[model samples]
Structure formats: C-alpha cells, structure tokens
Target: MTDHVDVLIVGAGLSGIGAAHHIQAALPERTYAILEARDAIGGTWDLFRYPGVRSDSDMHTLGYRFRPWTQAKAIADGPSILRYIRDTATEAGIDRHIRFGHRVVRAEWSSENARWTVEAVHDGKPVHLAASFLYVCSGYYRYDAGHTPHFPGIERFGGTLVHPQHWPADLDYTGKQVVVIGSGATAVTIVPAMADRAAHVTMLQRSPTYIASLPAEDPIANRLRRLVGVRRAYPITRWKNVALSTLIYQLSRRRPQVMKSMIRKGAVQQLPPGYDIDTHFTPRYQPWDQRLCVAPDGDLFTAIRNGRASVVTDHITEFSETGLRLESGAELEADIVITATGLRLLAFGGIQLTVDGRDITPPETMAYKGMMLSGVPNFAFTIGYTNASWTLKADLVSEYVVRLLRHLDTHGYDQCVPTNADPGLTEQPLLDFQAGYVLRSIDEFPKAGSRAPWRLGMSYAHDVLKLRYGRVDDGVLRCQRRPTRDAAIPAES
Candidate 1:
C-alpha cells in the first residue's frame, strides 16, 4: 500500500527544511514528508566537502527568517551551515519526518483523484507514495556530477586533478604547487585556502571576473546584536544587506561603465601598487554581467600580494605532460589541478512528471509567480534570486506556498493551477544572469512571460509585496474541486 501524505517535499536541503517549518506552522493539520536523496541532511552543504567551502551570501540573509543566526561571523563555513540546518531540523522535530536515501524518480498526478503518485528508489528498492500536493525543493543543479569541460590532452597531464564538487577527503596538497581553473566563486575560495598549505597556488582563468572584498564579520551587525539582541538584529541586518545588494545590482545594470570602474578600483586598491590589475583583475564584461566573486577580507588578494598565490589571465590551449600549455605559449606546472568549473542545472531534480498520463516538460511551461509553473496543478518549486541572497526569495516562496495551501483548505479546493491566458504575452528566459552555469542550462528550464504574475521579478522587495501579501485568488490562478463519482453520474437516464 502506498503511504499517503498531504504534502511530499523533495530534497532535505535548506529550502526543504524551511518549507517543512512553514507548513508545520501555517497548515498544521496537513501531514507532510521530506524525501532526501542523500544518506544525511544538509543537501548542498553536506554534499560539498571542498576546502574553504562557505556561503557566498552572508548568514544574516542566507539564514532562514524564522531562525536567527547567532554566529559572530557573517560568512559561515560549510560545516557551520550544516550544523545550523541540522540543529534547526532537530529543534523543530522535522528530522523525524525526513526519509533519507529516498530518490524520487517520477511523479504522476491524477486530476480524477487529485493526488500525486510519487515513485522513488530507497535502499535499492522501489517505494511508492501518494500526496495531495507536491513541492520541489531539490535545488537547481546536478549533485552527482558538476559540469567539467573537457580540455585537449587532459589525460596526458601527470598530476592529481580535482573538481571542487568532488574534492577527495584523503588527498594531500601540502607543499604542492596547485593550479585552479576557472575564476568563479569556487576558484577564488580554493586558491586562498590551498595557498595557506600548498607551496604556491595559481588561479587560471580564460577571462577575469569582478572580485569584491568584504569583512568576514559584519561590524554593523555585530554592534546591533550587542545592543538590540539577535532576534531584532537579524531582520535589521538582513534588510540592510538586501538594500545594499539591490542598490549595487541596480547600479550595475543602469550604469555599467561606472559600476565596472568602481569594482576595478576596489580590486586595484587591494593589490600591490605595480601589480597588473588591468590584465589580471579587470574583467572584459561589465560588473554583474556574471555574479561578482566575493573573497572575505581580501583573502585572495592578500595571498597574491604575499607571494603565496598568483593569477594568470589566459586561455588553456591544451594540457601538457606536467601541466597546461596556454594559448600564449606559456606553461603552468603544477602538482595538483583543481577544476572549479561550474554546475549543470537540473530542473525539478531531473524527476519526470506526468499529468493524468500526459508527460509534462518544464521547459514547455511558463513560470507563475516564480514559484509555481503554468498548467501544473497543486505543485510549486522554490527558485531563488540570482541577484540576492537565495533564502530571502526562498523564505518568501515558502510563506506564499503556505498561504496557497491554506486557501485551498479553506475553499475546499482539490487543485489549483496557473494557466497562461494571454496568447500575446512574450516569453523570456527565467534568469537574466550571464553566468556560465545559467547560460548552459537556461534552455532546459522554464520561461517567464513579459508581464507580472507570469514574469519573475528578481527583486526581494517586489517579490515580498507580490508573493507574501498578494491575493491567492488572483484571476489567473484557477482553483477547482475534485470530481466525485456522484457528481459525474447522471441523475436519471
């Protein structure tokens, strides 16, 4: 017999745990279960074991709104994040409801029964479960493997190659010359981290990315916490960070050259007087064309200034026997090569979905309110903002979902779906970011219309007003009751 639940949430990550908390708080009567593919909690945090792994966004904003981050450091490491997630689950008694090692393969929704029959693999066996509503919080990327671009003659390199996503626990890099490929967040993080122990570390990139140096501990937040306590300090700090991030993003979009100059100037100040900032620190593209890389306390620049690390802005033509041969005919010799490439985005954790025996492809549908998809019934997915802290959008999404569920319960509706009514509406890519990972997978994801309710506003302020306080019965979202046998039957025939 298939176990029935009011809601079935996929993934036990930061989003899933937060979703559970919201559901338990708002719709206490509805029973739900979280299915985690991994053997433990903390989806991304637990999965990524790379050195110097930490949140790019500060804890004040990254942390859930319901919970206050009591840590002194705004930029928290992976283990600390994992502990925070685990502790939240433990305190909320959400840990008991999570079924680890359960990987959902397919979800079939039947309008007749108004339920989703979810099939998953657990402990090398097939398990079936049914739910009234399905929530996808599995995150946006493939966890099994990261996107590692093939290099010419990569096999000829006689050195240890590592991807930050799958960093080996037992591997030793002490006194070794390390070459890290790609200039994204991972490369910047690993360069400074490995530089501390390695003989030397080099960050090799085809082009440059805008790098920002921020204090690990936020002084304003620290002062506020001491004065007003953590509970009050959190929201204040979160809003301040949100406004600052929004202002920067807005400036970058509106005045690209001005923002670009500002970012370059910041990077230049951190480097040595005669350092080639134009060649190494300056990016070809404007600031925020791709997400800016943040190095807490100018760590990456500090390492480079102290001669422990270096930056090479050049393309890799091919891999040499010892290391890489650049397009400029320069050779980089290294004992270990870390490929901090990027992630391959996966929609709905690659779980196949069907609506009453009809296959449903995410790319074919349009996003509704950035939470639910068009033509999808009783289903919602949490996708965070690219411009700001992910949890800021995540928390709003969770709150909106709870509000939606409660509306259904109050109205006695079995299903609610956002159908695209306007044929004239122009479709756009869900994300506007030009990051490599986003560009690689944008076609595979859903589209958003040019108008509101159909379009995704990447602003937290906009989302809060629309998602949190907006009416649930807004004309586009159609709610209906399940058809019963009696209702389908003719009175007299």
Candidate 2:
C-alpha cells in the first residue's frame, strides 16, 4: 500500500512520540505518521525486561519537557517507565497515528520530486510511503542484539547464559548463584536486584566503572509538588535537576582529581569498614570519561554490606563448566551468567539512505546541530547527551524539527539542506564518549566538527539557546524552492 504524509517519523519511542506532540500542536495542518518496527509503544522499555531495570538518569530530565513526571520515584523502574510512555501515547492520541510492524529498510530522496520515497516491510509484505521530511528517532543502539564478547569455553558452561537485552520470561534464578559480567548501568542494577532472590549475586568486571549514588526520590521535587501543582512544579524541578547534573559534569571535566576523590570518599562511606574500595571502585579514567553508572540510594552498596552481593575485579580467562575462570587463578561458581556487557551501536536504525540513486554514507557527512546531517536535505536524527538525560537533547531536537518545518512553510521552500562550505574544517568523532559500544562502532556514524552548528551538544542549556530560539535559516542551512511536477502541496491555512 502507498501512503503520503507531510512528515514521516521513525520509531514510536520517547523521541518520536514527543516529536509528534510538538508538530501536531504547532502545525496542526501538517499530516504526520510514526513508523514503529516493534509492536509496542515503549521502545527501549519494551525491549529490555531484565530484573530491577530502571532509568540511570532521574525522570525529571528524562521525562518529556512538555509532559509533567508526576510519579514519586525520580528513578523509575522499567514497568513504570513503560506505563508512562503508553499513557503519554494514549493521552496525546499519538498511538492512533502509529503504524506498528513497519520496519523501514530504505529511504530515497529525490531533488526533483522534493520528497522522500520510503520503503518498509510490514508483515512480510512490501509497503511504500512518501514524506516531505524524515525524522529518525530509532536511537543509536541495536535493539536486536547486545554486545557479548567471545568468552572462551562458553559452550562448556552447564548453567544458563543470557544477555540482558533479550531476557527470557520463564528463566528463574531463585535461590541460585548468579554472576553478572560488566560494570555498566545494567550490571549495577541487576546485581542489587537479583540479590533478593538469588543465593548470591556477584558483579564481575574486567575493570572498574564510575558508579554514582542518587536518591530514588527527590525530596525537593516532592515538596514542590505538594506546595504547588504538578504542572507548575515539573519545569522547576526539571531545571533544578538539569542544573545540578550540568554542574557535576562540568566539575568532573574541569577538576578530575577533586571529583574522583569525592566519589571515592562517598564509596568509602557506603561500603564495609575494611572493604577493598581501591580494587573494585577505582576507575583508571576520569569521571564522565565514559558514562557513569547510577546506583539509586546506594542499593548496590547495601547489597554488598548485607552479604547478598559482591564485586570481583579481574579478567575472565575462560568459562568453566560451573562458571568463569579468572586470570588470577580464581573461579566463580554460578547457576546463571548474565552478560550485561553493552549494546551494539547501529547507525540510522540500519536503514539504507539514497539521494537521487546515490548512496548516502554517514561517515562522509558532517552532523549539523548534532541532529541534521550535512547535504542530507529534510533529514534529521535524534541523538541525546551521553553525560545527561537522553530526553533533554531529544526534546530539543523535536522542537527544532517543528521550528524548521514552520520556517519551511513560512518561506514556501521545498528543501533546506545544511552545507559545510568551510574547506579547512577539522573532523572529529560525533560522540566524545569512550564507552566500549561507542568505541567499537564510532566510525559507522557521522563526523562532528570543531565549530558551532557542526559540533554535537553535551550541554542542555546551550542546546536550549541554539535549538529552541536560534534562527532556523542559519547561514549553514540553505533553504531553496524548486519546481515540482506532482500533486498540489498543502497550503498553510
């Protein structure tokens, strides 16, 4: 079947839903549709079903800027988050516009046609659609698989081996020994959570990662909600959290030694009296060098103190019949092994892009405003901040897209392409983050520049000024009108 829309949005996750809300509210005349590959509303939330899964960042900044996060827990669980997403979809009537099971494989842009011809597969049948603009919100990581390195002798392990991305429903670990590998957000969350039912839970990491403790509920936010209404308190609390996070990130970057000392001191206060904090808690890199793992109210530490969970710092020589054998001549016994290693980075949802029959290579292009790509007309991809809440940058990108669409309508322009005219521009990695997933696949994504409108955003306040209020017709982005021999385009009311 063939379909046409003023805008075509990919992935009905947090960003896509938020984008639809902004576009529908501002430009009600513009027809839009969301193509979700999954059958559910919550993208990441629905995909991951591991025990004790929750948001690493607080919900205030992670939640939609337009919508108020009225929940008590600032660090919400997976089910709560999924419910929130579903509620948002239903409240906005955004679910009605979603085309589920539509896996978009390719998008072709035609200059003469002044639109994108999108090809997708739905229920094993080919589907065709056209749109004036394409907004990709499918996120950066691969949903189908998580990164699990080759563990020597993995086949010999008798117990169950699983990846957190695809957690099994029927699998039970009650009163069973569990060993989780890696020290990322997923591992920290799983270690404490599984400790309740497991005989013992151990987090085995090759090296240490920075793990910070945050309160599960924000006292200031709760008080404000009681004093004022939810809607009014939301923005205030959101900004407060944003400011606090920004300050931490900035301080960590500027004063690495001071921040590291502070973090170590905090860990010393939480763990046992004579615990080996140096071996298990100390990271070689500076704070925020890689993304810091969040531990709500020091639950991970509590689990360790109570002898429910423990941390092992060593390299895995190989997998044994019972568990993992470390290089330090130590063996860990386990009934279940959870590889919370990391995610595999995928570019543009692995969708092929062609412009006038010529393939568009992401690595060859430059990111414009960290959303739009250079020379890629009417195309934008939402990539959030690595240091802060993802939704912070995502909301900005959505607003920017809406503003750009409005500008196009105002000028009667058919195309707006961002061109990097500067010949002496220096190229850099799109994300400065040193996470294993990013390091493994950074070359597959677009490059960032050393200057403004080309460099990726790490600060929410800076993006607010740039994306929210900045001129849509910035010198870099060129707007043009071309004669199109096709059906009449919709006129502004």
Tens-place lDDT digits, model 2, residues 176-267: 99999999999999999999999999999999998888899999999999999899999999999999998899999999998899899989
Off by over 4 Å in 1: 485-493
lDDT of 1 by residue, 355-438 (tens): 989899989999999889888899999999888888898899999999888888787788898989897999999988899999
Per-candidate local distance difference test: 0.91, 0.92
RMSD of 2: 2.5
TM-score of each: 0.97, 0.97
Off by over 4 Å in 2: 485-493
